[model samples]
Target: MRKYIIILISVIIIAFGGFYMKHQYDKKEAELQYFNQAKEKMENYLHENYKNIKEINFSDSYSINPMGGISVEGYLNGNKAKEFYGIYDKSNDEIGVSSVDAEEKSE
Candidate 1:
């Protein structure tokens, strides 16, 4: 009887551990998806609006806004000192740029 109880507890623990791991994995996956989408949206926005920008690099950290959108900070043309902020609005599938200091290139 004691052996059976031990086995039962062990099984329960393993099941719960598996469930927790799965939940964590799903959460991370969702976060990664959001990050990728936000990065892509920001890149597209910059390319369309800023003709001189040839390269884009985003920071590793981001924030979640009150409206459930993702906000990120990045720099253009390999200049890390000059940073720009952008937000990806999930509901409207739009990206808004703010505090950009990138100058337009002469044609």
Candidate 2:
């Protein structure tokens, strides 16, 4: 009976662990998808509005704050540019461009 109880508890713990892991993965995946969508929108907006800029580039730098705010860094026409894209809402396809900054290009 003692051995059986230990085995049962082990199985239950493993099952709970698996469930928690899966839940975490799903949450992260959703956040990733939202970030991608926001990035795409920002790219499109830059291309259309910032016509003089030859290239709008994204770097490896990215961050997600505790409140789920996202920030991404990149380059604009060879100058460093960073943008803060606020929380994403699927129902509202419009992405709010919170802030954007670009270093002046030097001759």
Clashes of each: 0, 0
lDDT per residue as tens, model 1, 1-107: 99999999999999999999999999989988998999898887777666678788899898887878899788888988878898889888988646666875454
Against the hidden reference, what TM-scores do the models get?
0.87, 0.70
TM-score of 2: 0.70
In model 2, the clashing pairs are none
Q: Judging by lDDT against the true structure, name the best candidate.
A: 1
User: Against the unseen true structure, what C-alpha lDDT does each candidate score?
Assistant: 0.84, 0.63
Deviation of model 1 at 87, angstroms: 1.3
Mark the regions of model 2 whose C-alpha exceeds 4 Å error after superposition: 60-70, 81-89, 101-107
Model 2 lDDT tens row, 1-107: 99999999999999999999999999889877767876777676565544465666766555666655565556666665343333333455644444455433343
> Candidate 2 local accuracy as lDDT?
0.63
